[model samples]
Target: MPVAIRSGVAEPVWFVLTAIVFLVLLRRGQRRATPAAVLVTGAIVVAGSLLLPFVLPPVADDPGTGGPGIDGAVNPLINLGDDLRQGGDVPALTYTTSSTQGVYLRLATLDKFDGRQWEPADIDPARTHDVAKFPAPTGLTSAVKRRTLKASVQVDDISGRWLPVPYPASRITGVDDDWKWVAGGLTVRSRSTSASGQHYTASFLDLKPDLAQLRAATPSPVGMPLDVSVPTGMPAIIAQTALRVTANATTEYDKAVALQDYFQSDGGFTYSETAPVDQHYDGSGADIIAQFLQKKAGYCVHFSSAMAIMARTLGIPARVVVGFQPGTPASVNDKRVFQVSSHDLHAWPELYFAGIGWLRFEPTPGRGVLPTYSDPQAVDDAINQGGGTASPGATASAGPSSSASDPGGASAAPSASAGAATATDRADATPWIVLIVLLVAIALLFTPAAIRAAQRARRMRAVARGRDPAGNAWAELRDTARDNGWAAPDTQTPREFAERLTVTLASSAARIDGLRRGVETTAYARAPGPIRVEDLRSVVKAIGASTSGRDRVRAVLLPPSLVARVRGDEE
Candidate 1:
C-alpha cells in the first residue's frame, strides 16, 4: 500500500479482527462469549494501533508544516479574506496612548503590483537601516506640522516577523529582537525574530498637514521611484477611471482626494467581505481592480488596492499598507487600553506628496477614520463659514459620510442639522427597544413554568368542586415526580410507584401510601368514600420538597413533564 493508504489502514484491520473473533467464538459452542471476545479484540486492536506511528519511520516531507510562516511573504488580499473569515474576535495586540485620535499600527507595505497580486517591495540593503535609531522621515519638511506621541504596545496573540509600529516612528525601545527599519516607509521588521511576545514603546511623529499645505504640494518621485511606477500590461480601466474621476481636480492633493472619495463614497461602492470572493476577483491584481470598479462592492482590500493603483496611474506615488485599525477601548489593571484583534486587520492606501512624504488616505468605507485634511469638502466648508482652515489638531471623523453628503459642492449645513436630529432620535429610542426585547425574552423563558402552574391550579379547583379528587391528586403527584426527574414507567402500578418513592421521601412515605390507597379505591371501589383534597395537595408538596435545589429550579423554569406530555410520552 502507498504511505497515504497505509497510514489509515488500522481501522479496517481492527474491524476484520473483531468480526473474526465473533465468528470463532460462536462456532466453538461459546455463543455467550462472542460479545465479550469481540469487545476485547477491538480494545486490543485500538491499543496496538496507537503505537503504529511510533514504530513507523517518519516521512521526509510532512504536509502539516507547509503553511504561511512568520515574516514570510504573504498576499495582502488573501490575508484580508482569512482575517474576515475568522469566527471569533481574537486579540492580536493592545496599546495605551494618551492621544485621543485613533492609531494605525502598520505592519507591512505592498508596493509591488505584478498584475496578479500585490507584494512587499524588495528590501534594498541601502534603504534598510538598523533599528537602534531611526533616521528622519523621508521627504517630510517643516511645512507639514507634526507632533511627537508615545505609545506602549503589548503583543498578545499575533505572530509575524514584521513589528506593528505607528508610521513615521522616530525611535522604538524595549523590544528584545534585533529589528531593522526600512527608511522610505519607516516599517520595522526582523530577519529571524517573531513578534509573538513583545512589549515595546514607540515614539512617532503624528503628522497633521493643513488643507492649504497639501493642496500646494506637488507629487515628487525623487526618492520613491518604485511607488510611482505602474507595471506594464496592466488593466486599462484603472488608469481610465482615475483620469475620469479626477478630471475636475487640478493639484496632486485634489486628485488624490478625488480618488479616495470615488471608492469611499461617490462610486456607489458598498463594503462586503465576501463579494469579491463570490465574484471570482478576490485579489489586488490589476484585473481584480478593473472588476472591482465594475462590481462596486468589496471589503478594505479591494477598496485600498483600487485606490492605490488608480493613484499610481495618475503619476502619484502610492502603496497598500496592511495593519490594524484603531481597536475597541477597554480597561485592564485600572489602566485604559485599546485592544486590537484579528478582526481589525485592515489595508489602506498611502499617497505621497513632495513636502508631506507619504500621506495616509482612507478609501475604505465604514472601516477607519477619514482624516479631516483629506476631506476637501469639510476643509472648504470650515473656511467658507469664517472658521478658517481646519485646525491641525482637529479630530478626524469616521465613515464615508464624514465629509459632504452632496458631492456637487453644495453647503452641507442643512443635511448635517437633519442628520444630527435623526441620530438623537435613535439614541433616545435605543433603551426602550432593549427593554421591550428583554421583557419579551423573559416571558418566553418562563412560558413552560407558567403553563405548568396554571394546569396545577385548574386541577386544584376541580378537586375542590368534588370532581374526582383522588384521581386528580394522583395525576398531580406523578407530574410532580416527573418534573423533578423522577419518572415512573406506565407499567408500574400506583402502589408500586409509591413504594419506590418511600426510599427518597422517607419522611412523607405514610402520606404517599395513603394517596396511593385513595387512588386505588377510587378506581376499583363502586361506592368509594370521599377523599380530602388537602391530603392530595400535601402529598404533591412532599415529593417537590424531597428534590435537590438544582432540580427544584429546573422544574420551576423548564419542567421536563410539560415537554414529555406534549410529545405524547406520558399518559
Candidate 2:
C-alpha cells in the first residue's frame, strides 16, 4: 500500500483540542447581563458545543480502530498512560484479586479521518491494506530457549470500557475480543466493564527471531513508510542518522540487527520527557524526528517516532505502537494468584515486512516480555481463528462507579457539604461552580445600592406626607430583623444594646468593639449610606460572631442552600 507514515507532533494537536472542551463548558459564558430566556438558549448551545462530547466520541484525533469500544472515541484520556500522566489520581499500582481486567487502554488507532474528525469504525477495510510494504529491522537470532512470564491487570477508577494488555499478546482467553486472534490481535481490545471487578492471566513468551532463519524465510520490505511531503531539509539529516546506525551492515538482516543493537546499547537508553519548548512545539514533524534521532535519548514515543522517520529515509514502512508490556504480578489472589496494576503501560514499534504482517520490536532501553501461547486449546483456536472472540480475563469491569462509600458506609448522601465539599464534587461542579460565583458577585455589586435608594425615596415620601421618617427607617430595619432571625428591642438606647450584647458574652472584647462602631454609626452619624445597618445587624441579629461560633460551623452541617445553618443563614 501507499506508505501511511505519521509523526508524533500530529497527535498532540488533536489531544489538546479535545481536553479544552472540558474547561470551556465550565463557564456560563458571556450571558451575565442577558435575561433568562436568552441565557437558557445560550447555555444549550454551549452544552452542545462542549458537554455533548462527554456523551459522544471525539471524532477529530482518533482513527477508527474498532467500533469505539465502550471506552468510546476518547480512549486516550481514559487509559492509565494518558489519563494518569496528565493529572488527577496517581493510578493504583497494585492489581489485586478485585481489580479490573479485559480493559484495552488503546493508544492511537485511526480508521478514517474525514477532513475534520475521526470516524472510529467507518473506514473501509479495503483502504487499510497497504499493497507496497517497506523494509524494517528484524534479524534471526538462533537461541531457542523460550522463557515464559505471566502478568495480570486490574482496573479501579477508570471509565470508558476496553481491556488493558501490553502489546504482542500472543494468546488471550478466559475473558471476552467477544475470542478472535487476528495474528496481530496481540493488542488488547474489550468492550465491557465489570461490577465486582476482574482478574486474568497472560503468558509472555521470549523468542529469539534468528536473523539467518528470518532472512532465509522470506525476502521482505522494511516496515517504515514514507511520504513525498517530508520537509526536504530534514530528510537528508534523517538519512545521515540512519546511515550512522546501519553503515557496518552488509545484509538487510544485518542492518535490522544493527539498528536494534544501537537502541539496546547503554548510550541509547535515556528517558526523555523534555522537548525544546519553542522549537519542538512547532509543527515541523520532520524536524522533530531529526532532533530526536540526534539526541538519542527520549521516551518510547520519541524513540518510535524518530525510528519511523529515519526508516522512511531508507524506504521502510514503520509505525509506533503505544500499549503496555506484559505486566509484573500485581498481587497474589485468594487462590494466591498474582495481579498487575495499570503502571505497566508502555510503548514500542511495529515494523512490517512482506508476508509477515507486523513484528514487534522494542527500541526502548529495557526489554518487555511479549505474550506466548502454550495451551493446546490456544493452539487449536489459533489454527481456527475465530471472530473478535479472543479477549482477556473472566471478570469485566462492570460500569464506572456511581458511588464512593465512606469507610463506615453510613455517611449521608452527598448534597454539597454544609461548609466545605468533597474534592470530587468540587471538581465535577467546575462549570456550574464558576458561573454561580460570578452571578452572586454581580448581584452583590448592584443589589446593595439599589435597595438603599428605594429605601431613601420611601422615607422622603413619608416625611412629605407627614409620616414618621425615623419610624419608617426603624420599621424597615425591624422587617429585615425579623427575616434575619433578629428581634430589635421596641425601645432601646445605644447603652442598652451594648449591655444586652455584653450579657451574652462577657469576655467578647473584640466583638464588642464592632458592636460599638455599629451603634455610633446608627444612633449618631447614620443615614444615606446605611452606616447604622451594621450596628442593628449586630444587636437585633447575630453578626460578627467568632468564626468558631454558630455561623462557620453551620455551613458544613446543613450542606445544601435550603438547609438553614443559623436559623436564617440559609439565604
Candidate 3:
C-alpha cells in the first residue's frame, strides 16, 4: 500500500485486533479470572511496548535528524533530500495577498557555517523581542525603492516552533505572546508554542532595487563577520571557482550577479533530488559543496549552500535561507489564496550589500523565481550601453537607462531597453504556476482530515493535563461517533447514549458503561475522582476501530462533527 493509505489504516487494524483478543481471553477466563491477573497482563504489555525502542534500530531518514521535515523545521546544511523524496504534495499553509511580485515565506536563516554544516548564529537575549512588532531590517537604506504589503496566513498542516513569515516583517498580529522576534534576521520563533493552529497577518516591505543601485553599493562587513568567515579546512576549489566565475565582473554587485548566473544559467548544473544521495555527497558541508561544484547535479540545498559559501570566499557576506516559494494561486470562497505544500520546500541564498541589506538571489535553476534585480544579462547590457549607472531615484519599473533623456528612446536605443524587456519576459515565464495548480485540488481535498487530526491532538493534550478530562474525552467520543455515522441526540441522557453506542458498535459493553458513569459523575457529583485519559483514549480507539473502512474514510475526509458545529448543533 502507499504510505498515505497505510498510515490511515495500520493503527486501526492493530488496535482492533488487540481489542478482539483481549475480549475473547476475558470471556474464556470469566470463571477463574481475578483483578490481579488482569493487572499483570496489562503490566506485561506496557513493559514490552516500552522496550521496543531499544530493540529496534534507529531510522536514518527520520525528520530533524539530517533533513527538513514536512513541518517547517529544517537542518539546511545537513541534507534536505529525505522530505523531497516523500513524494507527496501535502499542504503546509495558505495565504492571501494583493502583491503581484512572488512571495517567499521564510522560516529561518543560517548565518554561521561550522566545519560540519551551517547553523543560525547564537541567540542574543538583548536582540530578542516580543513578536508583536519587529525592528527595522538590517542595513536597509532609504535610497532603495520599496512598498509595504500585507499578507494573511493560515497554517493548515505544518507544525513546529519556527513561525513562517515574509522577510523583513514590520508588524505581525494574531500569534501567541510566546512567539519571539529574532532581530538578527527578522525571523519569528517560539520556545513554548508550536506554529500549528496560528492565523497571523504580516506587514512587510517589498524591496525593489535596480541593478545600478546594487552595482554602486559597496560590500559592508561592519557588524557581520561570521557571514564572510570560511573555515580553515574548507576545500581550496571553493575560492578558486568563485574567483574564476566573477573574474570578468568589476564591481561587487556585478560579481554577485556573475556568481548567480554561473550556477543558474551558465554552469550547466542539473536539478536532481536523488543525484546527491546516489553520489554520496548529499550534505551542504564544505567537502559536499566542493563535490557538487564538480558533479554539477543536485537540488536546491546543494545549489544554495554552494552559492553562499562561494560568495563568502570572495569577501561577500552571504547566508542560506530555508523556506517555501510562492505557491499555486487559487480561489477559495471567492477570495484569491496562495496554497503552499511540502513539495514547494526550497532553499536559496541571500547576499548582503550596503544600503540594501540582504537581497535574495535565486541561484537554483528551475526552482524559484529569479528576482528581476539579479538578472545578470540585463545588468551587463545596461552597463555596456549606458554609462554603467542609473540615477539614485531609479525604480524597478524603469530600465537602467531610463534616466537618459533621448526623444527617440523607444526606437533608437534597443540595447538600452533590453533590461526592461528581460524583466518583462521573466515575469511572464512562470512555469511553476501551471504545474502547482494541478496539485492544489488534492491538497484542499485532505484539508478537513488534517484539521480534525489537529483538533484531536489538542484535545488529547488537554486531557493529559487533567483539565476536565471527563468532559473533553466525552466530547471527543461524541464527535467520533457522529463522524462514524452514529448519532447521540441532545435529548438522550448519558446512560441512554452509552447503551445505544454499545449496541451500534458491538464493542465491549463494560468500556461504554464505564465512560457513561464517568460523564455522569463529573456532571452531577459535587466532587468526582479523576478519570484516566489512557482509559478514555482506549475506549475511543475501540469505537473508531469498530467502523467499516468506507465509513472511516468518509469520516476522515468530510467529518460531520465539524459541520454540526457550524450548524449550531451539539451532537
Report the alpha-carbon TM-score of model 3 versus the true structure.
Answer: 0.55
lDDT of 2 by residue, 1-571 (tens): 0001211112322433433454346434543322222333333443333334334543422322233122222223222223213433333223322222222222333221111111122111222222121111123122422233344545433333334442333344355423222112233333333311334554433332323333443323444232212235554666786788888866544454456556656245555434422234211145444565666655444454455445445544444444333333333444433322334344444444443334444455543421112111332342233211121221112211101101110010100000011111222344564355345434433443345446545754663454543444444444333333344455765456556556755665445455455435555664522333333334333422423454433322222222222123422
**Candidate 2 segments exceeding 4 Å error:** 1-153, 156-158, 166-171, 176-198, 201-208, 217-235, 264-269, 275-285, 329-342, 353-357, 366-571
TM-score of 1: 0.55
Error (Å) of candidate 1 at residue 533 is 99
Error of 1 at 62 (Å): 17
Clashes of each: 0, 62, 0
lDDT of 3 by residue, 158-220 (tens): 655567788778889998677777756777777656676679998887666656677888777
Per-residue lDDT of 28 in model 1: 72
Over 4 Å off, model 1: 1-77, 123-128, 221-224, 377-571
Q: Compared with the true structure, what per-residue lDDT tens digits does model 1 show for residues 1-571?
A: 2322223223434444554576566547543333333334434443333334335763321112222322212323344555666677667788887455447777777776655556666433243476657887767888766567777898776555667788778889997446777656677776656676679988777666666878988887555555457889987888999999999999999998898788766888888877876776666667667888999988777787788788888988777777777676677999878877777777778877777777777778877666656766566554444332233433324432222111111100000001111222233343454345345445555667889999898888877887887777777778888888896777789888999888888887777778788788888888654566776788778778878788998787767677666545544
Q: For model 2, what is the alpha-carbon lDDT of residue 450? A: 47
Error of 2 at 216 (Å): 3.4
Better of 2 and 3 by TM-score: 3
